[model samples]
Target: MTDTIPNPESEGPSGGWGSVKSIARILGDDKPSPMVLEELARQNKPGGVMCVSCAWPKPANYHPFEFCENGAKATISDLTSARCTPGFWSDHTVQSLRGWKDYDLEQTGRLTHPLRYDEASDRYVEVSWDQAFDDIGQTLKSLPRESVVFYSSGHAGLEASYLYALLARTYGNNNLPQSSNMCHETTSVGLQKVIGSPVGTVVWEDLEKADAFFFFGQNPGSNSPRFLHPLQEAKKRGAKIVTFNPVVEQGLVSFVNPQSPVDMLTGRETQISDEYLQVKAGGDIAAILGLCKVVVEADDAAVSTGAARVLDIAFIDEHTVGLESFIDLVRSTDWSVIEKESGLTETAIRGAGELYIQAERVIGVYGMGLTQHSQGALNVAMVVNLLLLRGNIGREGAGCCPVRGHSNVQGQRTVGIAEKAKLIPMDKLKALFDFDPPTEDGVTIVDAVKGMMSGQIKATISLGGNLVRAVPDQKAMEEAWASQDLTVVVSTKLNRSHLFPGKKAYILPCLSRLERDEQASGPQSVTTEDSFSHISGSVGKRTPASKHLKSELAIVTSIAKATVAPNPKLKWDEWTADYSLVRDLIEATYPDQFGAYNERMFEPSGFYRGNSAHDRVWKTEEKKAVFTTPKQLNALSFDDAEGRLRLITMRSNDQFNTTIYGYSDRFRGIEGTRDVLLMCREDIRSAGLSEGQEVKLVSDFNDGVRRELAGLKVREHNLPRGTIGAYYPEANVLIAIDHHDELSKTPASKAVPVRIEA
Candidate 1:
């Protein structure tokens, strides 16, 4: 079946769900996957099944009608009956495929066989698993291990990620450039710097007991729907849930819990946030500073009037430091400056502060929205500062929560994906494999792209992801791809990455987590660590898409054997043939937690990885949770210019990350078209544009790139002035490579300044 691109003109304005034309434009010209309907059927089955996308098990605790709209869409996407067999690659050359749209490319379906780029034919031809591994091994053997960079995506399983890291380390390079570097690296960097750990200090259960919840720059309704339930519960309990984001996300203000039986049956929706404050773009640091100022003022007044105690004196004196400096900074800063910088009035800032002071416990939850900014690290530290003031850390229902995107992204970092100049993972690899791993720090994702573009790097082996679309400066990334000697992609379906093949490119099809993994022992179960540090078993419920397709673990093992001589002490074949052996190796490597990895996962509900922060055991050198003082008192704010606005790139309700599941974002009233820019009515009128006016938004970055998204209809959203919103992947073009957090190297996707043109 030939795929069809949707016409952009047929899509209507950005009011409530645009007309059919907009849907077509958003989906491009691709035909609906036959698997979509099939997947929907499975989703609506009597007993809910596991989603193949995130490996999220069907929660049994909730009512029968527990699925969210996005969950249903994710299930349908996995069930898509698209197939891109070896013949399709044989028919189309890499050059020809390059011209195809991203939607059409993925619509081709799951790859059926291992394929290698045949430069002579200019096409990807089918190759046997053995030959493919042997060739990849030869390539690795030929190059200095430092030259071979292993890139991992969030979509990969824990087993696959572990193997990828092992392969790279075994081959003598720790150059593991991963997807996390682009997303939540700021959280890891900031939290570690302040609290001496990369993970969040709170568990999911803590959300329920918190008196007040401070949500910073995250829209759970669209990003992680599962979180909506907890927020809903918090709201129902009369807890004040305050939101701080540039855009007034519908999910944060109110949400219809499709999982709640009464809400689903009666079409009832619950209010999520008691107070939603739209802070200026890139102004999180300022807003937080303003809030801290209010806290400090309230405490001084309380002490003077003898009304009530504002400061947690006992907790502060026992567990923290730098209180005097923090208070001094807050006192020194004036309300006028804070209001100007945060775009929030003194009343709103004080009200937020009053809520914080009155609450017995408060939990601060944030996502990439808070981390992907120029002052991302400081913003994080500021949030930590607020918690420290209240003695929130290591206490019940009060701490820091960095809501990670991928299911196992955090776990990947924990296992050994560090790109730091100094870490002992390489030394551990040397002890385990009896081979000296590279001591030199490896390139991160951005660094790898720069290296490839500058001809310092030769080959890139991506475990699973659409790297080209995910990274910034697509044109530069494409150029870097053209310069590479070889580019290997291990994936289940065709994506934008497959089209951007190098001179010699290979596409190796692998098994999805939902598909049964048949090893010599039997069906295997993989474990994933969620944002809360809960390690759960993921067992496949569906049959393999194709018998020829190999498990990612098997493929990685084969490649590893082909690349290096087997260690006399370790049995690589045994581990590959049985996943238990791999688990045993992991348990042996990290004995502190996974002493008996196989036994623990078999339990119906898996175990929680011990979090030292959960019990208030501060692991800092001083053995106390330290209060970090903000370097600057004023919040970071941008000035509004003619035709210029600060644009925040967000996911549509129907989308997740780069995968455009469907065109309709019900919450935003955006339908069919993904190109529409969201701007407040006043901002639109100020720019001399009408509701449905065609316009070009040019980036204010040094690169001076322009994105032509025509005729965006203006909606009177309760967003901050001088700020607008756009969907990602498309808007990704507007973000420059240099616009990144200094400490974390995370791209500032949330704070790109742009101007609309007629």
Candidate 2:
């Protein structure tokens, strides 16, 4: 046994002297001080660099050093002094590098030059950009456009993603699957069905107008620490915050803002969540359903007594459809079933719902915890249903806020990075590019992985992401990834996905967000959209890491120019030389959204791309938002399997999506390891297991295929009896690739059924 101890206690309240020191250590870790310092000072400011980390919105009245520890880590990690040169490539082979950790691989640092995988030596060799681009372009042109998938990551800015989408469409395909496909695809698909919009319906300032906040399946304390400031402010102003999660999170409990002088000087901490409910993993919808029953029943009572009704009759009658069915569903649902599934009592759930009923304006916030599940769409739909009951959609400080994880993830989707052909305006595309674009539905992440496995996907052109690690079924993904004909990745630093190269693999070096991207006109400023639907400018001031490196826009343009034959209407070089042309094309493409293009984005406060749902403009068939119901409430609602547990894959304090900075999880009081399974003591006894017991996890999906992970040490936690928590990507091995939500096809990382065996 490893004898690794688990500390369920948090290190301290979120963001104190500890977070600052953590950031300091990373900045001091072989990074150039002056450049990094200057970059930090200008980060998330007017005419400043947008964080390449989380998509949390920035404040208009910014703090002097407006950044979280995670932001600093992301910046320092990318602007590293270490460089991956041709010599470094020779030092490590493809097969040898597979065993390396994700953190170690990225820590080796940025790729200095474009490189191609050599079969004979099993190594990557330096290649000129011209040859690499020509080869990749020729191969893409040779294949049927449907066989190619343009995989864009969350890191790329608006201009690059927009051009990348155009590159895919003009080359004759709609197979543009990006990061959002895996994370928030559920939110997009579900919300669009209900509200006619695929994004959230709130601005950052809306937090100020709220009397209460109901947070579910989100941990901003770790993933998006910058949000703590506003939550802190909200709590200070006596706004009630009700949180629902599987585990105790430090930020939701209390917070000590690093930027606040009083907090640092006096060691004062602000309490965050007034009511913290530890609902079972994937029971958010069930809990929400319970809440609905509470509100509807209360409304009936209020009507009889001639008091204020709990449900908003006017909004429900005029602005929504399927109201009767929704009410019927809520009334028909039994409290026994809700309590059984939600791992919460009727009294507890009603208390939380009462807070919602009392507050005039409420904000409902959620994250991947609710989205990465079998009923992920239902999870989102239920929240909307709850909000609509109180006429919350168009109200100030009261709406649905799906806090996005990575930077520009939403902007990518907004600017046409989608697999659905209908989502892309075919008429506008035909008129603008003057080419016959593919109108067929393309592969999503799940379909793409399946395609690669079955040898249908011939090529994958990634703009920036650790796809293999981010996806499920690790063993199969690696096999299918290496089996492909071509795998092209454009990135600033190396990741595990790069190690599993195809037969003809290429790692193309690109400019980081920290470096100046100068085009033919002069220096350029790229724009990124945030969780709030706000767009801001990012201008990198640091020097380029390598002279041989090219901007992502330049690389994508080269490939497109080489692949597609000369078009008299297209100006590839001109657009690549001056990004303003790309922005102009964006303007023509999304006139209402990006009008004025280059000018409005640089405004000090940025600009909010208004949400129609927020303005009470329903873009659906009947011009009204609908109340959606779950087709089937499966394993996520409850798991009754004997000797089984519901597994939720989570990130630690020192982690991002698929990127674990160190072995230690800062807030969780864990150090030097991430291979431990978190379980409540009762569950351990029930399973005939002891603390720190070495065990193997077996997937219990009843599928013919066998999936097991050995050597994970068990650690006691505060989770519900039938639920266990483990680090994401590490526990991802136990989840089958096809185990996902039916509506959105989002991999159910949060609600896998598994068992521990000694």
The candidate scoring highest on lDDT is: 2
Tens digits of per-residue lDDT for model 2 on 1-758? 01111225677788998798777767666475367878888989888988889999888898998888888888888788898898996678988988888778867877899999899998989999999999998888889878888998888989988889988988888888888878899999988888888999988778988999999989988889998988888977889899888888887888898888899999898878878888888778788888888999999999999998888999989899887888888898899988888888898899888888989999999998888888888888888989998899987989999999999999999989999988887788789878888888888999999999999998899998888888888888888988988999998778888888897999999998889888888998788999988888899888898999899889989999989888877788998888888888888888888888788887766788789999999987768988876554433744577887899888988777877666657677778888888899999998889998999998888877788888789888878878898888878888888888778888999988898889
Compare the candidates by TM-score and give the number of the best one: 2
Q: Report the Cα RMSD per candidate.
A: 5.8, 3.0
Which residue pairs in candidate 2 collide? none
lDDT of 1 at 402: 87
Model 2 CA deviation exceeding 4 Å by range: 1-8, 30-33, 631-639
| Model 1 local distance difference test score | 0.72
Total clashes in model 1, counting residue pairs 3 or more apart in sequence or in different chains: 20
> What lDDT tens digits, residue by residue, belong to model 1 across residues 434-467?
7776677888887888788788888888888888
